[model samples]
Target chain A: MKHFVDTLHISGIREFSEMYINKEDCIFLTIGEPDFNTPTEIKDALKLALDENHTHYPPICGNHELRQRIAKLESMSFFESYTENNVIITNGATEALILAMGVLLGHGDNVMIPTPCFPLYQTQALLTGAEVSNYDTSTHGFQLRYHEFSKHIKENTKVIVLASPNNPTGIVYDEESMITLHRLMEEHPDLYVIIDEVYRSMIYEGEYPSIRDYESTIDRVILVQSFSKTFAMTGWRVGYAVAQESLIKQMNAFHQNLVTGVATFIQEAAITALDVDTQFMLDEYDHRRKYLLKRLALMDVDYIRPEGAFYIFIDIRKYGMDSYTFCKQLADELGVVIIPGIFFGTEGFARISYGANMDSLENGLDRLDQFIREFCL
Target chain B: MKHFVDTLHISGIREFSEMYINKEDCIFLTIGEPDFNTPTEIKDALKLALDENHTHYPPICGNHELRQRIAKLESMSFFESYTENNVIITNGATEALILAMGVLLGHGDNVMIPTPCFPLYQTQALLTGAEVSNYDTSTHGFQLRYHEFSKHIKENTKVIVLASPNNPTGIVYDEESMITLHRLMEEHPDLYVIIDEVYRSMIYEGEYPSIRDYESTIDRVILVQSFSKTFAMTGWRVGYAVAQESLIKQMNAFHQNLVTGVATFIQEAAITALDVDTQFMLDEYDHRRKYLLKRLALMDVDYIRPEGAFYIFIDIRKYGMDSYTFCKQLADELGVVIIPGIFFGTEGFARISYGANMDSLENGLDRLDQFIREFCL
Candidate 1:
C-alpha cells in the first residue's frame, strides 16, 4: 500500500529475468549473467573457508587478509598503489557504486552520467535527491561525446560515473579521451570521478589502461572493480572500490552500519579468484565478442564495434520501430530475446550479449536476421 | 573532506573491534559476533553450490530454493504462513532494515524507537532524513513505555521500529505490551511496523509473539530476520524480510538497485542453517543469560534481568563518570572491553555482551566488579 520513492522506477533484474525464465523454447540475450562456472581454485578456497570455521562476522570493511590481497591485486594489475585503508570490499559492485554516490553527492547536487549507461547510476542519484545530467552518446558511435560531456559539467556536478569496457556499448574509453578528461579534472578539483572498472579483465584490446595509470590526476578518483565478470563469480557478489583512504574511511562507516561485510566464505573465494590463473574464460569471452560483432556486420546491422566485454550495441533505427517494440516482436516471432537499448537509455537500438554459448548465439542471430528481413523489407 | 549527509555514523561495534582485535592482552565482551563455526550441513550446502558452479548472478530477489526454504521454516517455527513471494532476501538484516526505512519513511517523517537500542535505527533514520523519537526504556526496565510512545506519534509519524529480544538490552517485549501496541496500531491504520527479528531464535523467555500472530496486523507487519546469530553465519551475510507481497516487491526493487541480492553460495548455506535444530545453542544462551543476570543482581551494579538475546545493560552512574570515559577506563584498567551506552544514545550506562566463553565472562565480570568498587568508593 505505501508507495516507495519515485526514483526506484524499475522493478529489478527480475523484471527482465521473468521475460525468458519460464519459456523453455526461447533463446534469451536479455540477462547479464555470465555462463561460466566459478573457477575451481576459487571454489576450493570457499570450501576451505567453510571447513576452517571462518563463518563468524568478518571485519566490517572486510577481512583484513582479503582487503590486503585486494590492495596487492590493484597495485600489481592497475598500477594503482593503494593500501588496505583505500579498499572497502562490498556486497557487489552495485553496492559499491550506490555507496559511492551516497557519500559523494548531496541533495540538489548533480552527477554526470553518459546515456546508454547502466540504469543504477541515475536511479541511485535520484534516490539521494541528487539531479542527473545526461550526455547522449548514441550518435557518437556509443562513445562519450567529449565536447558535450564538457559542456554539461556545471558547478553543481559533484560526481561523474563512467563504465569502462562499458555495459551495453562495450566501448572502452580511449587513452586520448581519458587523458583529456584527466586534464579537465584538474580544473574541476572539487568533482569526484567514479570509474566502474567491473569489466577490466574482459577487454580484448590487450589490457585496457585504467584511470589509475594517471596517478597525478587521481586525488578525486574512486575506482569500482568486481570479480563478478572476470571470475564468473557474480553469484558470489564480491567487489571492492579503490579510492583515497579518506573516501574509503567514509565508505567504511556506511558499510559498518549498512551491512557488516561481504560473506567471509565468499571473500575467501574472491581471494582465490584474484590470484588464480583463470584467463580461459576471459579469452573465451573475447572470442565470443569478436564473433558476435562479425555476425552483426554480416547481417548488415549498423552498429558500434565493441572493443571489450561481450556485448554489441546495434542501431535498429532502420526498422522504423523503437527498440522495446522490436525486441518484443523479435522474441515473439523469432524466439530470440534481446535487451532493448531504451532500457539502457538509448532508443532505436538494442544490446545483444555475446556471453551465451556458441550454438545459441548462431541460432539467435539467425532468428534476428530473418526477423529483420521480414520487418524491414 | 566533504561531509556526508550526517546520517551515517561510525558504529560502536567497529570501535570495540578496533580496541580488542590486535590487543593481545585484553579480553573482549563488546561485539555481537558468535563464536561457533557454521554448522557442517550448512557449510556443505555452500560447498555444493560452489562445486556445481552456481556462481553467476542469481535472481535479484533471491534464489527460489532459498526463499522457499525460508518461507517454510518461518511457517513451521513461528506459525506464520508466508509464500516465497512475501520474502525479500537481503545482503544482511541491516539492509533489510535500511530498505524498509527507505521505502516507508518520507523526508521529515517520524519513527518511534525504544531507547538504549541498536544505534542502527537512529542512523538509518538520519540517512532517510526522517525524525527518530525515542521511547526511553532505561527507566522502565528496558521495555517500551507505551505512554511515551503514543504521545510521540503524529501525522508525520509513519513507522515504528522494534527489535524483539533486543540488541543492547536483550529484553523481549511482554505479551501485554504487544497487545497494547497491536490495539494502538489498529487505531492508526496508516502506520507501518518494521520489526527486526534478527534475534528471534535467541529468545530465552515465554513464547515470542511475532506481530504476525495478530490477524489484522498481517498486512502492515514487516518481519526482518537473519542467519547471523542463530547459525553463527554472521560472516555469511544472509538475511531476509517477510511482509505482504506488495512490501516485498517494493523492498526487492530497492534491493536490486542497491545491493542486488545475497551471495548465492551464502544463500544456500543460510537455507541449511534455517533447517537445522538450534535448540542446543538456544538452551546454552538461556543458561548463560540467567547466570549473568544472577551475577549482576549480587553486584553493586544496576541492570534489568534480560529475558532474551545475549547482552546485559548495566547502569554505570555510580562511578560518577560519563559512559564513554568510564568504558575506556574500564577497558584499560580492568583489561576488559565493554561498549559504552552512549554509543546507543543517552548517558551513564554500559552494555556488555555475555556471549563470550564462560571463562572470559567470569574473569571479565570479576575485573569489572573490582574496577567499579574502586572508582565508586
Candidate 2:
C-alpha cells in the first residue's frame, strides 16, 4: 500500500515546453539543450569506431582508454590523488547522480539540495525514500552561503548536492564560498558532497572553481560532469564521476546493475572528444551570454548576471503572477518558450536559456521586452 | 556511513573470465558474450545515422520510431494492448531490469528470483533496499515449478523475476509452466511478474513460450529484453521493456533519471535493427548448440541439455569441489574458464557458454574432458 510515486510530481518544464515543439515560429528558450552541432572530430571518431566494429560491451566501469582519458582530465581539473579507480563512466551525469544517491543515501536519510537546482536531485532522493532538505538560495543570488549548510545540516543528513555553475541562476560558487563550505564539511566528516559541473565548460567569466581545489583529499568531493554541455554531446549521454576510489567502486556496482556502461562506440567517440575543439560552442555561448546580460540590464528587473551556463534567472514577482502562469502566458501570447522557476522549486522567477542562435535570442528577448513594456505598466 | 555496496559482491563471471582476455592459449567459455561479429546491417545503419548526426538526447521514454518498431514487434509477439506507451527503451536489458525494480519494489518489499540465474536481479533489488527471496530451481532441473512460487510467496512478495531460456542453465519455459505461473499471479493480483527474454532469440528448439500467449492484457507481465545476445550487439547496450502503460510510465520516470534513455543515433540504429536478417545468427547458434549437445552426450558428467541459451549447466559435483573452487582449479590447471554456478546461486554445476565459435568450444570442451578424467578418478 505504500507507494513512492505519489511523493513525486514531474516538473513543469516539460509540461509547458512540449507544446511549443511543433510551432515553427515560436522562439523557444525553454530546455537547457545547446544548439551547437556535435564536433566533426568526435563524430568522425564514432564513424570510424562503427566501421571498426567497436560495438561490443566495454567493461562495466568503462573502456579503459576512455576512463584513462577522463582520469588525465580529472587530474588537471580535480585532484592528483585520483587514478583510473577514481573514475567510472556512466549513462551521463544523470546516472552519475543516481549512483551517488544509491551509495550515499538510504531510506529516511536526508539529502540537502539548494532550491532551483536540477529537479533530478530531489527526484532521485525521493525515489530512494530519502527526504529532501531544500534550502532556498533565492535570497543569496542562488549561491550557497556557509550559514545555509549550518542551519540545515541534520543528524540524518547524508549528502549535500551542489551544482555549479548552477542551473537556472548560472551562479558559480566563488573560491571563498567553496573553502568555507569545505571547512564546515571538514567539521562533519560524515557528510558527503557531490558537485555537478556540467556547465563548467560554458563559464563566461573567471576560472571554474571546484570543491577539489579546497579539499586536501578526494575523500569527500564527488565531481559529476558530462560531455553533453561541453562537447555538444547531450544526446550521447556520456558523463562521469570523480571521487575516492571506494566511492567510485560502489557507484560502479550500482551502474553495473543499471546500464553496464555507456555504449561502446559512444565511449570511443567520447575518447576522441577529449581532443576535439570545444571553443566554437563555448565562444558562441559567450556571445549569446553577453547579449542576454545586456537585455537583462535594460529590462529594469531584478536578475542576477549569469556567470556561467546559458540560462538567465529573472524575477517575475512584480507581475504578481505565479511562475507557471507567467511562463504559460508568455509562451501562448508572445510565442516564446521559457521554463517556470517553480519547476526548479522556486516561484516568482523563470529561467531563459540562451543556448540558441543569436537570431532566436534576439527575437525571444524582444518579445520578452514587449511583454514587459505592456505588463510592467 | 550506510552503504548498499556491502550487499553487492561482484559476480565471478568477470573475475575468472578476465584472466583469459590476454592469454592466447586460454579456452574461455565464461561470459555470455557472443563471439559472432555484429551483423553488418545494424553497424551500417548506425554508421549512416552518425553521419546524419542523429546524436541528441532522446526523450526520457525513447525516440518515436524506435518505440514504434518495438511496439510493432510486441504487437505480433505480445498483446494487442501494447502501443508506444507500453514500451520504454533502456540502456540494455540490465537497465531495463533495474528500472523494473525501481518502479515495482520498495524498501523491505520482497522479490522472488529463481536460481541459478543472472546475478544482476539480486543486485538491483538490494540496491533499492528490497529483500530478495531466492528460490533454488536446481532441484527442478532449473525450471520454475508452481510449487516454487507457492513456497516463496510471502506477505510482502511484490514481484516474481523470471528469465526464459534461462541463463547458465539454458532451459526455456515450456507453455504449461508459463501458464501455471500466470495462474499463480492471477490468484494474487498484487504480485507482478517480470520475465527477462534477452535470450529468446537464441532458442535452438521449440517455440519460445511467452506470458502473452495466455494473457490478453499486459498488466501483470513485464518483458525485459536486449539486442545484445540476439543481434550480436552486446556492446551497444540497447534494450527495452514492455508492460502496461502505467508500469511503463513509472519505469520511464526512473529511466529518465537513470540515463535519460539510450543514445540518439544508437536508437536510430535500433530502428533498423528490427529489419536486419536474424536467421544467419540463429542458424549459427543452432549449429553451435548441436555441437555442444553432442559433446555433452559423450561426456561422463551430469548436465542439463540446453534448450535455447548458449550455456550448458554441467554438474561438476563428481569432482567434489564448490563451484568457485572448481572454476578456479579448471582455469589454473586445464587452461579453460567456466563460470562458477555458485555465482548464480546454485552449487555443484558450472555454466559453459557455446556463444563462441566452433574452435573455442571444441578446445574448451576437450580441456574440460581432460580435467574430469584427471579429477573424477
Candidate 3:
C-alpha cells in the first residue's frame, strides 16, 4: 500500500537534524522557535481578551481590530497601503505560505524558491502537486542574483517564494536585488510573488525594503509575516498576510474552511503585539546578534556574516567532517547545540542561533571552542 | 481570471445568513453555535494559564494533562479504553475530520458520508480530491439504515463518515443500528469509519452507543468529538480524535505539520472543562433541549423530533417556498433567523437551534408562528 503521496516526501531540514541528534544529551539548535517568553504586554493583552469575553468565534478572515493593526503596521513600515479587507490572519506564517501557494498554484504549476531557505516553501509546493525549482544561492554568498533567478522563470512558473533575512542563511536581500526581482515580476504579469518577511523586524543593519514598496507599480505581490519571531510569540502562533483584495477573497474562503480563524482571544491579544511590543523583542535579538558575531570573529571561523536575523551560518567544512556529524559530535562533546547546515541543504556549514540567553550562549560557545580544538585539530 | 477550483462553490448558507439577513430586525435561528458563554471555571482556567505563563508552544500531539483528561472522560463515557497515546487534540472537530481524511484518503479514494450532514465531511473530501458518495438517511427518519449503508460499501469505498444524533435531523442512531453497523464493519476489514460525535453529550435519550464500545473488536474506527457544543467553548476551538495507534501515528505527523497543535492556554482551560465542570454543562444542555422541543411542539411546526443536540430540523415544504427563500423571508419579516436545510445538503427543511435563552426561544417561536400564519398559508 502507498502510505503517503509521492509529493509528500518533500522533507523539512528539521527531519535530518532530528535523525542525527541524540535525545538525552544533545544541546541542539535545531528549531527556529524564539527562546524568549512572550512579551509581558502581549501576555496581558491575551488575558484581557479572555476576561472581556472575546472567546467566541471572530470573523473567518480575522477580527477587525487585528486586521486594522496589521494594515497600519504594514503601511507604516513598508509604506504599503493595505486595508483590513486586503489582509487575512492565519495560524502562522507557515499556514499563510501554504494558503498563498494553494491560491496561486494548481497541479504541475512551478514555483521558484531560494535554496538554503526554510524548507516549508518547497514542501508546500510539493504538497499541492506543484513542482519546486530551486535557485541555488550557496555560491553567491547565499544571495539571489537577478540573472540566476531570471534563468528559472519560465512559462509555467506560477509563483516565487522569497524570504528576507533568509532562513538558515540569515542574509537580507539588498535593495537593488529586490528592485530587480520586482522588475522581473512586473514583466510576468501572470506570476504571483510571495514574500515571507516573518523575520521582518529582526534586521541588523540596512532598513528592510519590502516588495510591497513596489506595490503601487506592481500588480502581484503577497506579504506574509508573523508575530512569532518579532514578539517572541512562536507558541502563540499568530500571523497575517497582505495582498490585493482579489487574492484575499480567495484566501479568506480557504481560511474559513481551514481553521475558521485564530482564537478571538488570541486575535485581541495580538493587536497589542502588532501595536506595541514587537520592537523591544527585536532590539534584544539585535544585541544577541552582535554578541554572537563577535565571538565568531574571535574563533576565526569562516562565515558569510548575516546582515539581519539572529542566526550565524559558520562554515565547519574546515573541520573535515560532514555538517550533521559535526553538529552531533559537537553537542555530545561540548554540551552545546547548534543546527547542522545539512538541514538547510547546505552541507558544509552549521547554523548557530543567538536567540538564547547570554549565559547559555557564553557557556555554550566556550564549550564549542574546546570541542573544536580537541576534535578538529 | 479563474480564481477558484472548478468543483468548488461558495456555501449558500453562509452567503444568506451573513449577507441577506437584516441587522435591525433579524432574530437569527441560523446559529451553528452554542448560545451560552464558556463556563466560568473554564474561563478561569484560561486566566490561570496566562497568569502562570503557559503561553509556550504546546506539544504537537497536545499537552499531556489534557490528553489524559480526554482519555479518561471518553473512556468513562463510552465504556472503552483509551490511553493518552490514542488521542490527538485538534483545532476543532473540523480539523480532526480534515486530518483524518488527509491521512486515510489519497486521490480517487471514496469516502461514504451521510447526506443532510455537516457540509465539512464532504468539503474535506473534496479538498483531498476524493469522491464523496452519500447515503440518504432522510427517508428513514434520519437513522443510519444498515442494509442501505452496506449496499454502498463497494470495493472502492475506503471510509464511512457517520454522525450520531445527526446534525441536521437530530435523529440518534439507536443501539440496533449501531450493532448492525458494527457487524457490517466486522465483515469489511478494509473499510475505515470516521464517527463524528461532536454532539454526543447533547443527546437527551437512550444510551449514546458509540463505536468506541466495540474498540476492542473494531480496529478501524476513528472517533472525533469536540468541546464546542458540550462546553459552549466554540470560540476556544479545541477538540480531539481517538483511534488505534497506527492511525494516530500518521495523523499526529500531519497534525504537527498542519497547526503545530492547539493553543496551550485553551488546552489547559479545556482540561478543567473535561475534568471538573462537564456534568453541569451537559445537564444544562439537556434542560434546553427539552424546553426548545416543547416550544416546537406547541408552535404546530412539522418537524422531525430531535433526540439530541440543541437543534430541531423542521420540514418547511409545507411553507410553500424553498428553504433558502423561506428562511430569509421569515427572518426579514418575523425577526427570527434559522438556517436553511440546503446548508446541510437537504432542501425543503430548516434547522433551528434551541441553545439560545428561553426568552429568545419563546419570542422567536411566537414570531415563527406569526410568519407561518401570514406567509405560509
Candidate 4:
C-alpha cells in the first residue's frame, strides 16, 4: 500500500456507525438521506432514456442536453453567464470536489476550510498531497468570520471551501455573509474557492448565497450542487460542477480519467427533477426543525437553532464526557443514533439529523433527553 | 490550475477525430461502443428499482444483492473464495482502476505495463505520482512473453497491469499463458497485479486465462470487470473491483469520497444483466473480425490479426508516415475515421474498431484499401 493511502482514514461517521449497524432496532438519527420517494416525473424520464438507448459513453463532461438544462438552472440562481461548458456532470458533489481539488491543488498547495465542515474536502485535498488549514469556527457558532482569514490563511492556500446549510451544523450563509466571504476571496486572487450548495434548495430560514453573485469572485469559485438532498435521489449518483469554462475544462479533463460520467438515465431523470418543486420537503423539514427546536428550548440542552438543512448541533460541553463518548453511550444504553461533533473537528458537541420521519425523530430525541438527564446529572 | 494538470495533454486520438467528426459523409471505423442496445431484462430491472424507491445512498462498497451476485459471478471465473465483502461496485472500470492504483501505489512506486496499451493506465498513474515502466511488446506481436518479466521487475515495481482482449491490439491471454504469468507473480509476492478483463466476455478464441484459476496468485491480484463492453451498459455507470477483503475495504473507503456508489437502479439492472447471455454480440464481433482479416490479407498492408475484441491494429509504417499523419490524412481525404496508434504509446500502427454496423465497416475498409493504393504508392 502507498504511504499516503495509509494516512487517509475513513470519516468519523463511518467508524462509529459500523460498530453498531447490524444491531438493529436503534432509531438512527445520523441519516444523511432524505425520507421522500423520488418524484414520478423524474422516474419517467429515466425510463424514457433507457428506452431510447441512452446507454453509451456520455460526453466527457456530460450530455449537452443535461448541461444546457443545468446552465439554465444555474443562471436563474447565481450565474448569469453560465453555459453548457461550465457544468460537468459528476457521480455526485463528492466526485466534483475530488476532481476540483485534484486539478487545482498539489504538493505545497493548501486548502482553507472552516472546521466542522465536510471531511471530504480535507480527505480529497490530502489525497492530492495538499495540506489543509482549518479555521476553528466553533467559537463563532459555526458561521464564517472572514475577518479571521489572517489567522489561518497561508501563502500556499490555493482553495477555500465553504458549505452553506452545512452538514452537522446547518449554517446557511446569506447574501451579507457571502459578500464578505467574496471580498476575502478577491483579496487572495490566486486562491480558488469552492461553494458547496447541495442543500441550497432546502434552506428554510433564508435564501442561499452564491459567490457567483459577485462578478469579482465568480471566476474564482467552483459551485457544486447535488440532486440528492432536493430530489431525494441519493442513490442515483447525479450531481454537477458549475464554474467558468477554463476551470471546468481542466476539472473535466481530470474527471474523465476518474469516471466516464454519471449514468445517462440518471442524468435525464435529474433534468426532469429540475422542473419538480422542492417546496414540499422544505416545508416538511422546516416542521421537523421547529419541532426539534421547541423541545430543546424546554430542556437544559445548549444548542444553536438550525437555520437550514436537517441537523441540529447541540453542545454537550457541560457534561464531563467528550461528544464521542456521550453519543456512543447514549446509543448503547438507549436506542437512538447521533453523530459526535468531534467527528467534524469540534469536541464538545453532537449532531442529530431530523431528516427522518416525525415519529423516529420524536422517539430518538426522547431517548436522547433521558440519556442527557441521567448522564449529565 | 495545478502544474500537473497543465502538463497533461489531450490524446492524439481526440486530436485527429475532432478534425473530422463534423465533416459529413464520413464512415466512422473509430467506434468503441457495441452496436447492440442494453438487454431488455436489464432495463426492466432498472425500472423495477426506480419503482421500488431504491433511491437512497447505497453501502460504500455496494448493495449486498448486487455484490453477492458479483461474487457468485466472479467465483465462476477467477476467484472461488470471493465474497460480497471483497467486491466494491464502482462508477465504471475507470474509477475501479483509479481506486486500485491510488490504494496500492504511491510516489517512488513503479508500474510496469506493455507498450501500445490503454493510455488511461499511464494517465492515472502519472496523476497519482507513480512512475511507469513501459515494455515494448510490438516486437513480439503484442503478446506477453513471461520470461522477460525479470528484465523490467524492480524493487519499487509494485503493480503489473495486464489487459486481455486488450484495447487497440485485441490480444487475449489464453489459459496456458496465464498459468506462466501466475507462476511469475508467485515469485514476486510483494507486487500487485491488475487484470483488466473488460473485454473478457467478448472473447472469440479459447477460454480466457485468469490468475485466480491458480490459487497461489489469487490473493495478490485485483480483478477489474466492466459491464460496458459486454452488456452495452456504458452509460449506466456500473463496474466493480474484486480483491482481498482488506484491500477492498481500503478501496471502498477511498471510493466513498469519490462516489457514494453506483446508482441503486443501475446496480439492480446490472444484477439482471448478470443473467444476460452475450453470445449474439460475440458472434457478430467475430464475424467482423473475420471480415477485417480477410480484407487485410488482400490489401497491400502489414497487420497483426486480432484474436478477440472489436479492433484490428494495422501497421501504417509502410505508408511512409507516422500514424497521426496517416490517420488524419485518411479522415480528411477518404472521409473515414480511425484512431492513431501514437495515442496508445506505439507510433507506427493505427487501430480500426469493427464495432460499427456491417455496412459502415465494409464501406470504411474499402476506402482504407484505396487510400493505401494511392498514398502508399
Candidate 5:
C-alpha cells in the first residue's frame, strides 16, 4: 500500500455527516449541495438524449457542443476569448481540481493553498506527493492579504489554490485580492493558480472577481467550475476546467484515463442547463440566508455574513469549544447537524449551510440558539 | 509540470477513432461498447429517480441499495460472501482501475500487466509513479501462461492486472490459468491481483473462470465490474470494485475526492440494470462474433476466435506493415476503421470490434476484405 493512501483519511465533513445521517429527527445543515432538484428542462433534455440512444462513450474531453457552450459562457463572464479547445468537461470540479494538481504538481513540489480551505485541495495536493503550504485567511476576514500570501510561497511552490465564495466561509475574494493575486503571479512567473468557482453563479451581491480579469496572467490560471451548485445537478457529476490550450491539452490527456468523460446524455442535459435560469434557486437561497442571518443576529451569535454560496461560518471560539466538539454536541443534544471548521483547515469555527429547506434552517437555528444558551451564554 | 503528465499520451485507440469519427461514409469497428441502447427498464428507473428528485450526492461509497444488490449478485457469482462494505461504486471501470492502482501502487512499486492489454492499465500504473511490467500474452494465444508470468514478478511487484475477455483479443482466461494464479498468490503473500471483469457478462462460451473460485485467495483479489458493456450503459459512467473491507475503505477514502460517487439517479438505474437480462445483447454479440470469424476465415486472415467481449485481434504482421500503417491505410482507402494493437502494448496486430451494427460490421468486413487483397496480398 502507498504511504499516501495511509495518510488519506475520509474527509472530516463526511465522517461527521455520516455519524448523524441516520439519526431520527436530525436536521442536517452539513450539505454542500443545493437542496433543490435538477431543473426540469435539464431533466427533459437528458430524457430526450436517452431516447435518442446517446449511450455510448462520449469523446474523452467532452461533447463538443457542451464544451463550446461552456467556453462561450466562460469567455463572456471572464471577459476573455476562450474557445472549445480551452475547456475539458470533467466528472465534477473535484476531478477537475485533481486533474489540475496532477498536471502541475509532482513529488517535492509545493502547492500553496489558503486555509481554511476545502480539504480536497490539501488531500489532492498530497496525493501527488506535493507539499502543502497553507496561508490562513481566518484572521483577515477570510480574504487573502498579499504580504501574508507571499510569505507562504517557497521556491518550490508551483501552484496556488483559491476558491471564491469559499466553503466554510462564503466570502468571495474581492477585486483587490484578485488584482493582488495577479500581481503575485506576475512576480512569480513559474506560479500557477487554480481558481475554484463552483459557486460562481450563486453570488447574491456584486460581480464575481476572477483572476482572468488580467489577461496577461490567463496562461497560468486553471479555472474549475461546476454545474453542481448553480444548476442543482451535483448528482449528474458534470463540471469543467477552463485554461489555456496547452494546459487543457495536458489535463485532457490525463482525463482520458480518469473516467473517459462524464456521461454523454448528461453532457447534453448540461447544455440545456446552461440555458436554464438559476435565479429562482438563488432567490430562495438568498431568502434563507437572510432569514438565518436575522435569527442568528437576534441570538447575538457572531458569523460571517456570506455574500455567496450557501454557507455561514459561525464563530464558536467564544463558546470555548473546538469546532468538532461544538458540532458533535449540537448534533447529539439538539439533533442539528453542522460541519466542523477543522475539516476545512481551520479550528474554532463551524460551517452552517443554508442549502437546506427553510423549515430545517429555522428549526436547526432555533436548536443551535438553545444549545448555545444552555452551554455557553 | 509532472514528468508523468509529459509521458502520458492519449491512447492510440482514441487517436485513430477521433480521426475517422467525423469522416463521411466511415464504417467504424473501433468501439468497445455495446451498440445497443440501455435497456428500457433501466432508463425508466433513472427517469423515475430524476422525477423523484434523487439529485443529490449519494454516499461516497455508493447508494446502499445498489451496493447491497451488487454484493448479492457478485457473492452468488463468485461463491464468496460479499457485503456492501466490500464494494465501492465508481465513475466507471476507468475510475475503479485508477483507484485500485492509486491505493496499491506508489513510487517505485511494480505492477505486472499482461499484453497486449488495455492501454489504461499501463497509463494508470504510470500515473501512480509505478513501473509497469508487461507479460506479453500475444505469444501464447492472449492467455497468461504461468511459467511466462513468473518471470515478470519482482520483489517490489505489488499488483498484477488481468483483464479477462480482454480488449482487442476477446479471450477469456481459462480455469487452469486462474488456478495457477491462485497458486502464485499463495507463493507471494504480498501480491494482489486486480481482475477486470468488465466483459464478464459478455462471454460466449463456458462459465467465466474467476480467481474468486478459490475462496482462500479472495482476500487478495480485487474484482472490478462495470455496467457499461453489460448493460449497454457506457454513457452512464457506472462501475464498482469489490474487494476486502479494508481495501474498500481505503479506496472509498480516495474515491470521495475522485468524483464523490457516480450520479445518484444513475445508481438507482444501475440497481434496475442488474435485473435487466443482457442475454439479448450477448446473443447479438455472439452472432456478430461468429459472422466476423467466418468472414475473416474466408478472407484467410489469421485472427483469434473471440470467446467473449466484442473484439477480434487480427494478425496483420503478415502484411509487412506496422499496425498503425495498416489501420490508417485501411481507414483511408476503404473508410473502415480499426485500432492498432500497438496501442495495447503490442505491435504488428490490429483490433476489429464486432460491436458495430450489423450493417456497418458487414460493410466494414467487406471493405476489410478488399483492403487485405489489394494491400496485403
Candidate 6:
C-alpha cells in the first residue's frame, strides 16, 4: 500500500453513522443529508431520459445542456463570464474537490484549509501528495479574518479551501470575510481558492455572499456546487465545479480518467433540478433549525447561532469529556447520535444536524438535554 | 498546476469522436460503448427506486444489498470465498482502476501495463506519481509470454494491469497465458494484478480464462468489472472491484473520499441488471464482428480476429502513413471515423469498433475500403 493509503482511514463521521445506523429507535442527528426525498419533476426527467435511451457515454465534461443550465444558474450570482466551457460536472462535490486538488497541488506544495472544516478536504489534499496547513477558525467564531488568514500562509501554499455555510459550524461567511479572503489572495498572486458552496442554496438569510463578487479574484476561485442538499438528491451523485477555462480544462482531464463524468441520464435530470423550487426544503430546515436552537438555549449550551446549512456545533468542553467520548456516551445511553467535532478537526465540541425530521429532532433534543443535565450539572 | 496535470491530455479517441461528432452523415466506429440501450428491466428498476424515494446517501463502499449481489454473482466464477466485504461499487471500471492504482501505487513505484493498452492506465499511474512501464505486447500477438513478461518486471514493479477482451485489440488471454502470469507472480510475492474484465460478459467464444483461477494468486488479484459493456449501461456510471478483504478496505477508504459512492438509486437498478439476459446484444455484436472480419479480409487488410470485445485492430502500416494521419484523412475525406491505434499506445494501426449498427458498420467498411484503395494501393 502507498504511504498515504496507509495513513488514510474512513471518515470519523461515517464511522459513527455506521456504528449506530441499525440501532433500534436511535435518533440520528449525525447525518449531513436532507431528510426530504428528491422532487418529483427531477425523478420524472430521469425516467424520461431512460425512455429516450440516453444510455451511451456522455461527453467527458458533461452534457452540454446541463453545463449550460448550470452556467446560467451560477452566472446570475457569480461571474457573468461563466459559460458551459467553464464547468465540468462531477460524481459529486467530493470528486470536484479532489479534481481541483489533483490539478493544482503536487509534492512539496501546501493546501491551507480552515480548521473544523469538512474532513474530506484534508484527506483529498493528502491524496494529492500535498501538505495540509490548517487555519484554525474556532478563534474567530469560525469566520475568515484577514489578519488571521494571512498568518497561515507559507511560500509553498498553493490553494486554500473554504466552505460557505460550513459543515459543522453552519456559519455562512459574511461579505466582510469574503473581502478579507480576496485581500489575502491578492497578496499571494499564486494562491487559488476552492469555495465549496454545496450548501449555498439552503441559506435562510440574505443572498449568499459569494467570493466571485470580487472581479479581480474571480479567476482564482473554483466554485464547487451540488444539488444534494437543496434538491435532496445526495444519492444521485451529481455536482459540478466552475472555474476559468484553462483551469477547467486541466480538471476535466483528471475528471475524464477518474470517473468519465457523471451518469448521463442523471445530468439530464440535473438540468431539471436547476429549475425546481427548493425554497420549501429550506423553509422546513429553517423551522427545524429554530426549534433546535430554542431547545439548545433552554439547556444552557454554548453554540454559535447557525445562519445557514443544517448543523449547530455546540461546545462540550464544560462536560470535561472529549467530543468523541461525549457523543459516544450520548448514543450509547440516550440513543441520540451527534457527530464528534474531532471529525472536522476540532475537539471539545459536537455537531448536531437539523436535517432530520421534526419528531426525531424533538426526541433527540429531549434526550440530549437529559444527558447534558446528568453530565454537566 | 501539478506537473502531471500539465502533462495529461484528453484521450485521442475522444478527440476524434468530438471532431466528427457533428459532421453530417459521418459513420463513427471510434466509440468504445455498446450501441444498445440499457436493458429495460434495469431502467424500470431505477424508476421504481425513484418512486420509493431511495435517493439518500448510500454506504460509502456501496449499498449493502448491491454488494451482496455482486459478491454472490462473482463467487460462482472467480473465488468461492468472495463475500460482500470483498467488493466495492465504484463510479465505473474507470474509477475502479484508478482506485486500485491509487491505493497500491505511490511515487518511485512502478506499474507495468501491456501495450497496445488502454491510454487511461498510463495517465492514472502517472497521477499517483508512479512510473508507468509499458511491456509492448504487440510483438507477441498482444498475449502474455512468460519470458517476455518477465523482461519488463523491475524491482519496484508493484502492479501489472491486464484487460481481457481488451479495448483496442479485443483479444482475450488464454488459459496458458493465465498460467504463465501465475508462475510469474509466484516468483514475485509482492506483485499485484488488476484484471479489467469489463468486457468479460461479451466474449463470443469459450469461457473467459480469469487469472483468479489460481487460488494462491487470487489474493493479489483485484478484479474490475462493469455493467456498461454487458448490459449497455455506459451512461449509468456503475461498476465494481473485487479483491481480498484487506485490499478492498484500503480501496474503500479512497472510494469514500473520492466520489462517496455511485448514485444510490443506480445501485438499486444495478441489482435488477444482474439478472438481465444480455445474449441478444452479444449475438448482435458477434454478427457485426463477423461481417467486419469478412469485409477486412476482402479488402486484404492485415488484422487479428477479435474473440470477445467489439473492436478489430487493423494494420494501417501498409498505407505508408501514421495511424493518426490515416485516420484523420479517412474521417475528413470519407466521413468514416475509426480510432487511431496510437491512442492505445501503438502506431501503424487503427481500431474499428463493431459496436455500431450493421448499417453503420457496412457503410463505414465501404468508406474504409475506398480510402485504402485510394491511398494504400
Task: Give the number of the best model, judged by TM-score.
Answer: 6
- Tens-place lDDT per residue, model 5, B1-377, is 27787799888777779898888999888988888889899899999998998888888899999999999988986678899999999989998998888889888799999898998899888988888898888787777677877877899998999899888798899887787788888888988999999998888987678888887778989989999989999989999999999999999988876787788999999999988888888888899989998999999999987789999999988899999899999999999999998899999889998888899988999999999889888
Proportion of native contacts found in each model? 0.66, 0.58, 0.28, 0.74, 0.80, 0.83
Chain B TM (all candidates): 0.93, 0.95, 0.92, 0.95, 0.97, 0.98
Q: Per-model C-alpha lDDT, please?
A: 0.79, 0.82, 0.77, 0.82, 0.88, 0.89
Query: TM-scores of the models, in the given order?
Result: 0.95, 0.96, 0.94, 0.96, 0.97, 0.98
lDDT string, candidate 4, B96-201, tens digits: 9988998888778899877788888888777667889997778766766777756777888888887888888988766655766676677778888898989888
Candidate 6's TM-score: 0.98
lDDT of 4 by residue, A83-140 (tens): 8988999988888888788778888888888878777777877777788888887887
Q: Please write out the lDDT profile of model 6 over residues B1-377, one tens digit for every residue.
A: 27778789998778778898899999988778888899889999999999999999988899899999999888987546678999999999999998899888988899999888889899988887789998777888888988878988989999999899787999998887798889888889999999999988878877688788998878899999888899999999899999989989999998887899999999999999999888899889889988888889998999977899999999988779999999999999999999899989999889998888999998888888998898768
Runs of candidate 4 exceeding 4 Å displacement = A174-176, B1-3, B146-149, B174-180
